[model samples]
Target chain A: MCDSCGCNITPGNRHLVAEGEPGHQAIDVLQHLLSANDHAAAHNREHFDRHGVLAYNLMSSPGAGKTALLEATLQALAGEFRIAVIEGDLETENDAERIRRHGVPAIQISTGSACHLDAHMVHHALHDLDLDAIDLLFIENVGNLVCPASFDLGQHRNLTLLSVPEGDDKPAKYPVMFRAADAVVFTKTDLLPVFDDFSIERATRYLRELASAAPVLNASVRSAQGLAAWLDWLRDDMRALRARIAGGEAVRPAVQPDGAALHAAESAA
Target chain B: MHELSVCQALVEQVVRVAREHGAGSVARVTIGVGALSGTEPALLRQAYPIACAGTPAEGSTLEINERPIRVRCALCGAETDARANRLLCGACGDWHTQLLSGDELLLEQVELAKLAEAI
Candidate 1:
């Protein structure tokens, strides 16, 4: 019996010590808690690449018109390219059902008590879709500005929408979310006339203050011109992604560095 | 809050590490939470107990090492601290700065509880 801490060391245990102070073993485990999610996200990304699909993660606060934008997009590019959706929400299948009504395959991920969708949830959603038939997939994330930005959903591009009603100060307040955006959209611009408090200039300046060069585009569900600009951006982005993929490269959205920044030794670089 | 979920992941990771080291229990779990991590440390501390309940890490202490937001300038190559909202190079005041750190949620270390004696 080992007299120090008493029990049976037996001289063979891996925690064996010849003659030293009995203490807790502190292991240097420099790992990210989000590694599992990042791995699952990488798997999903590879799956998307295999099927030549370009995925976009649409993020915003509640009532930011993510689904409305998708509906308009579906209407605009119905026959041109095959499209699908993965709608994530705390509850209800309303968004998925809405997308389904457009004759497109839409999968719903009901996270229940969870605030945001993780890669595993999106992985399950991908199982239901025919990726080969889809050229573009939009993962409309749960309506929260904070949590979703920290999670990666295996998308080629991350698009965050800030409605005019949400005010221009959002970018300054939610820096993490704004910084994760590859592109930001000013949604519900048609309401800007009534919501005179919202300023495009101020909002843009706030976004630029974060040192983010993410292109801000104007979009309103009511106007054709607004939708046209968004559709053009989408088409151009898809073309860029396709070109990259053709050149044996894949587009990587600027994921929140909480996990990726650690695993890839991005800090060391 | 999402910190609860993040804590869940943290517990999962700690338990896994504990098992890897043949640890029956854990005494402490240390992590680095960055200013720009989008996770609130207070919320994580609140969620820790719930996440550690019934796990090997139950009753363990969660030591949070808060990392400050830092950016490196392309012009001057100086790494300095910056505010969460403002990511400009603190030294050169350059807007063309890249994030050097501060978004990390790293599980830095873990202290395993009384090993062979406890067993």
Candidate 2:
């Protein structure tokens, strides 16, 4: 065990020896390695608080229509909210540009070889956008369901999207993502009939089992099916968020999005 | 897949800790990699060297302690180890279970090299 010291000490013995040595010592950290990223995320959350921005981290597999849903939601809620986006991808500013076309400011963070977007990257991207002017900030996370679940970007909520084409077993297959989700959106609902094997009831059941309190909403941008519910969720969430800020709460409460958006939609009509 | 970035973060923490303690170099870094941490130990081991290159942690030994996934079943009130990702209750065969452990990705300790003593 001791190739360097050549002493009759095991690796564990070396640890003890190192700790007892004059200058050499074994530091017992017992800390999460991602604490640095978590710290950065905390700072980002503080910034969002001062700006009254209700941030959402959108996570899903590739081609799950995250960008398309964002586009549709932006159009539907045009003048109601000041929305901005931070699009993350391994390559390309294409998603960011698409968001910009909807008249919302967006910043694309291209994480060269990184599969997930860390808090450090979001911290930099926050500086690039005018946070104070944004009512809502959408962090479209790397279009990835796995690695993104582990990294906290300090968003007010985490929403995991599962499209009908991706199958109903996604919640079970990728439990971490579902468990980490504040809410799960079933996107591309219009394609449900086409994909006979994809069951909304089954998906919702799994989502309920994993993320007990998280809402499982269905939306199809193509048919504008659940877009209203999606947009209302945003508006009502922002309203409650504004209320919290007005009341001097630094952080959002554990209040789930319980159809407040739907109530707002009804009142507007 | 993101083990490279995870290792990068690990290196940053190690370097910071090393500097704080006024250590010259890192001898060994011990960490816990849980079964459900979504990181591959092999990938992390491979990336550790690359992440450490050009830093004080260069050539430092990265010792990973694999932690098993532990779950607490609600039905049978039993705590059991969950092999793979089944997450079912071992005692009652129920899926109504909550995770108690195995998502941890922690840096347990760091062995710092001492400065050379005067003859």
Candidate 3:
């Protein structure tokens, strides 16, 4: 009997029987499975560039205060920056509704069973907004530390967030997310006094060990700590992006691994 | 798991390739999965059969090749393996190394069975 389906043939006959056939052939594909998604991401990048928008992909574990940080960012910088959001979630338009309450245009992408938002989903969300009218676009990916890190949504920057209550060991456990981040935000700082296990030093140490160039900052919507630095980072990035856009270049961060420690490491060397 | 989605795409690609080649059925599909590709091979293997169900590629064997992460040391000019969640250079213990491999998700090859000769 065949091993595969117990047919009236020799066991494990598929490979042998197929090879013996007259017209059987093997073809080399050598294709990346995500090539289609990458193509869509390239298109999304072009769209953002043409409209002079600085797009950011925000990733984090669930309940890491991604929405809260965005709310704070919009509240603080809305006067100077025309901001919009593409909120991704498994369900509920709650995030979109929250952003809309702040008078910012927002689009909600409900992935149903999908864990991460692919570039195609972002591309579809783009149609709901006037791209030229917005200066910055934030794609808040579904709250997943693992799956979201592997997918790129054509954002100019990839931001990863970790709340203090979630502990400082997240960087070590989810290194892929930290490695891909352009910036890391430590959120819910107001609870740090209660959560003793969370240490900025340990988190920074992990980042250093990974040789990451992403800058890390702590913020709390309650205390407004580090909000200025967060806003300044955005402002600097927006300026750099606009300059690149005007020069017909892709809006990449001017410096790789942009952070205080990276600069210190370079100087020490 | 995300493996289900990946397998779905894999089946789609296999079917498309089979159609392009005018083959009646797929005999085998070989995939190269990287260690750091964020995919669990075990889960993927389990999901493949389900993804192939109701498709022309059903019952096709999925042969997976595990690709190890390779990092090139900037200081020692040595290429070595990168352990899980660790990105340091295997040689010279330098943190400033470049990743050379282990993030790929490729559909390397496909074996197609010809239509059975008219009997």
Compare the candidates by DockQ and give the number of the best one.
1
Model 3, docking class? acceptable
Off by over 4 Å in 1: A1-21, A264-269, B114-119
Give interface RMSD for all predictions: 5.1, 6.1, 5.8
Model 1: per-residue Cα lDDT over A1-269, one tens digit each = 56667476432342234223355887878888788887788779889999999999999999999999999999889999999999999999999999999999999999998878999999998889989999999999999999998888778899999999999899999999998999999999999889999999999888876778899999998765478888999999899889998898746786456577465464346
Best by TM-score: 1
Distance from true location, Cα of A218 in model 2, Å: 1.0
CA lDDT of each candidate?
A: 0.86, 0.79, 0.80
Enumerate residue pairs that collide in model 2: none
Best by lDDT: 1
Model 3: lDDT of residue B65 = 79
Question: How would you class the docking of model 2?
Answer: acceptable
Over A6-87, each residue of candidate 2 has an lDDT whose tens digit, in order, gives 4766544455555665655688887676777766776788899877788988999999999999999888878978899999
Q: Tens-digit lDDT track for model 3 on B60-105?
A: 8888877788888887889988864677888778777777777668
Ranking by DockQ: 1, 3, 2
Off by over 4 Å in 2: A1-24, A208-212, A239-269, B73-77, B83-97, B115-119
A186 Cα displacement, candidate 2 (Å): 1.2
